[model samples]
Target chain A: MAAETKLFGKLKTAEQEHEDPKEQLMFDPRPREELNRMVMEMMTTTTKKFWLWAIGLGVGVVVLLFGAWGYMISTGMWVTGLRRPIFWGVFIVTFVFWIGISHAGTFVSAILRVFKAEFRRPFTRAAELMTTFGLAAGALYPLIHLGRVWVFYFMIPYPNARWLWVNFRSPLVWDLLAITTYLLSSTIYLYLPLVPDLAMARDRTTGIRHSAYKILALGWRGTEAEWFRLRKAIQIFAFAIIPVMFSVHTIVAWDFAVSQVAGWHSTIFGPYFIIGAILSGVSAVVTILYILRSTLKHMDYFLRPEHFDALGKLILVFSMAWAYFFFNDYLLGWYGGEAAVRQILTLHATGPAAWVWYLMLICNMAVPWLTLWNRKIRRTPWLMFIITLTINVGMFAERYTIVPLTLGHQRTPFDWGVYTPQPVEISIVLGTFCLFTFLYLITSRLIPMVPVWEVQEGQVAHTLRKIGKAEVPTVTELD
Target chain B: MAEVSIAEKWGLVVDQDRCTGCNACVVACSMENNVPFTGEDNVAFGRGTYWIYNKRMWEGEYPRVAPAFQPVMCQQCGSAPCEPVCPTFAAVHSEEEQINLQVYIRCIGTRYCANNCPYHARQFNFQDPDIPEPMNSYLNPDVTVRSKGVMEKCTFCVQRIVGGRQTASAEDRPLRDGEVTPACVAACPSGALVFGDLSDPNSRVSQMAQNERQYKLMDELGTKPKVTYLKGGGRNGG
Candidate 1:
């Protein structure tokens, strides 16, 4: 028994050399009231700087996204760089990027919850917010890219005077159904855990804020039955939404896969796109976490280096997975022996837009592989932020290469063309980015950015016990 | 009544050897179909609304170079890739005429159909038709002048086919095989283009479709294109 205890002591000291268990959010517990107050303060606190940024983003959305979209719609598709062959361009690329970003929320919240990862307590709400707003930003592109935005509803299946139904066989219809289902489900998933926090805010605030929280909280008294039902509802949605999230990106992939486009027609696209979505989505979560930590009040307590370290590990895994798919896609196309596919693959590497392809590789594959594996780098907030931001840029390049670049080259050499995005497309793309940030900014103030109740629950379940000569942190299954 | 029992199953045959690359067929089809001529910049930008355009291919290097022009229009494939992908059923196969049709009013312009078309035959109306005052009078009365934000393509001179059928029905006689030629075939100076009912095995298009040199573009794709091209090899034996 003495020898066994000594062996355990040595192992514990080795583990302690890397990280003090007390630095982890779960082990570093604060009083319930203090935690709640901190979150409420973050929500209520407003500065001139915040207003300036919000107003700036709002102006960007108005002019770049909506104004440009309206001008393009009224003037015609000619205003955009979309021409023959390159029918889908920057609009579609950014659309896919937003959808990919949205996947982060459901993945971090639902998947991590289902897996019972203790590190996911504080930042799940932040990630889930991305899913909702990312979708809002993404869902707009399908309409904005349309030739006639007025008749956009024609794609929706309804009993119309024309007595015609949308073609169910088309992948676009599937995309409409899938994205709608995902958005509704993910919003509900984000709200379920938020209810208890809202109830907490309701008890403390007055006037309009109190009334708003009261309604949003659904009159939660935090009774035993209410807690049980809330947990059960979240549990159900947690499992149910995983498939919905996967389906959303998979269907998005089918939009390209089901086409006869040379490089796009592949069976592997469904899983490849889903993996790509998760990579971008999870990287986005890290980016958002870094922003929140730096800007928001008292965020350093909830979002720690441990959380960044954990997310960095996830991003690294996803980056490797993305690389695997990228190579798999490339090799298969090269080996497929289809002349058009071969030509397209060559064009991607050596063509005018080869820089985009190289950027995709360097950012998506090389950066994460080189930097994220280091424990210090993973824990470094600003460095992880830069890496995650780079990954998203890489992801945007991936989508650009898949949509417009592939479309530009095909079987017929005479019809081959290159696409240069016009100013209108660039403005609209920037606008969606602003719209996402603006929505997030408004939502951050309106609701508890951190789920206070969840953090407290995790703290209650986590305990450090003395084992041999060292204290070891352990988590109890609260659910 | 007996003549109307069988669908026409219209087909076109292009004799590439006879085509002089003069673009007369392109001009005639544009005029007959009322296709808007986008300005020079727009045309250079690949926004030209030509229902038919000759794809010019350059063979060999500098001194040995020769340009071969292949006039490509909508093939009206029997099983078109564009039809199934269209969200609004804007691209539909006409059972009566046994050809593919684009319903202008139904198109929401997703451009998925254009992307799927192997021939790249479809054209989008990027801007409103800019026919100068006097030129507008020459626009065909039978065809609809498409506005911006809609997809248009060669309809196989569908209006002419309908008119020919009406005339034959009024006369109480079967429509002649050569009676309903598309504007392209009618205007071909070298008689390079032939249009007829392929449902009749003895039709001129059916006879030409069996020639040894006849081949469809990208036929291996199994789109089952209705248009056939006789190989052009008079100069280079290609």
Candidate 2:
């Protein structure tokens, strides 16, 4: 009966939709060809400014990565402000911060996908993009931190003419292995779902985009078998990658936690770091979505206030969880009456780097706690934008306190010294940002940022049935 | 068919009271194992790829937990949890030798083993190891330097075990335990750490294992690690 009515309704498709826009993002019919065309337009439409910015960033990256690093290698660690107390400085902090940012991508894409969150359909690719690029940027800090980048291979258990042994007993070696596993697995995870979208792009384009998509798409035709295999592969990866994601950050946390550093040593750090990563990372996603909507053409059609609102709910939840962990860590340390930990706490409040401490509290705790409570504020794109930016800065400050500032104050008062990075360190950080942007900007053009099939799948599963007085958006599980 | 004894329980005993936190162990471990010296920036950000860490703790204003430096590594456990959960067997435990080993070539860097591990003792190769040319020359020839995508952890010096085994065979003597020790244990000037076959009742490590202060890290999780710690010289001097 419904099928017959829907067939009859085809004659008045527009009229029926106007009468009941119950199928908002998904079922509101669109020519698959037109949607495909929009993706093509976004890719091929890069303007003069894009090229200029690209070139400028390109130039900046090479110089910063090569030039500054070259100087650090030649001069040694002294040029940087690192000393006895503040040994671990900005490099390590940036590493954690970037890794934290990377967490949002997998969490949003995988967990939400598992739960069938409809809002995740449009922005999953955008979030996934953050994972690959963010990891790439985060991975650089370890190399840069090596005062001598050239000899880093020693971490590899390789034997040469020397009869010496590569001791597998080092956590550094464990780290070397674990990160490699994560980066490759994540890249593969990011690529699996992207194949069909690439095929879609491949079919629409003519020049370079066509070739790029053709290679990436791997001749995907979305046949039942192909889709079946892709889905299976995705399922395996989703279940597999979640643990890997948790481990990657946890291992990263262990890089500090397993040791006895005042701030670094904590049994709770494994979950704590993972949670912190997700919180900051989700905020980053909000910021990215806001930028994409404001800057990219036709993004508003795809990204709506509803999406922002849904994400805001997540941010609010994550904020509360992060505070819980933060307080847990503080309460235990404060109660234990550990002198080094107290010094860290007092220094955090009234030390030389006190500004960073307050900024961290305000952005991470107060701002998110107070501002995100309002539904209108949470859903409002510009407001979310400002808040997300503030949160990132705040998270960075938090990491700074945990690392260098905490390092600055130890049991020995005489050995304490403040850490300051050289110009090289600062420039390289700029370079990493540029590299991330460069990669994201490049990716924006090639792959369809929006997963159309997912949206279509969502549409097929969704219906607006009248519930009492108002029509509520309803979804069904396609899988 | 011959019955095979896999390995005697491999363990490291850290005498915390003796550790000076002089960083000699850190440097020695890096030099012996090709650990890179990541700068303070990386270390501060928790990006340091250090496999061996020297740590200190201070508690309150007047009564601080005075500095206690400890060199912590993978506790190659009798019931190694990291081994069972690895999807690819990238990280495996040789029950024969009681070694928690990382196979870099096979490792896809899933890091699941790392997360399941309660000790937080594992590390991932976030980036390719940065070995300078001259320094690369200094790397041990026996072990295979790993690539970018793998999970790695302390193996209790497996290569050295292989070498020691070969030497023992060449001399036609049964392999005596304690012939090989990890760089961290070997480099300790204070002789605080003792490595040997825990299964063997007569070895020094075996005798030390029965001490009253013997405790495994995160013992509540039941990792059953070979490594034990004699905290603060066992106060009673056991």
lDDT of 2 by residue, B1-238 (tens): 1323465666678777677677776676677766655567666644465566665654335663356565677788777766654434556677678778887655544344554454545665544577777877889787677654345667777777667777777777766877977777778888878888777788889888778776776675566777888774436321
Candidate 2 reaches a DockQ of: 0.04
List each candidate's DockQ score: 0.83, 0.04
C-alpha root-mean-square deviation, each candidate: 4.3, 10.8
True contacts kept of each: 0.75, 0.00
**Which TM-score does chain B of candidate 1 obtain?**
0.95
Measured with C-alpha atoms, the lDDT of residue A419 in candidate 2 is: 69
Q: Encode model 1's per-residue lDDT on A27-127: one tens digit a residue.
A: 77889989989998999999999999999999999999999988998899998888898889999999999999999999999999999887999999999
Candidate 2 Cα outliers beyond 4 Å, as residue runs: A1-24, A27-29, A157-169, A465-472, B1-238
TM-score of chain A, cand. 2: 0.91
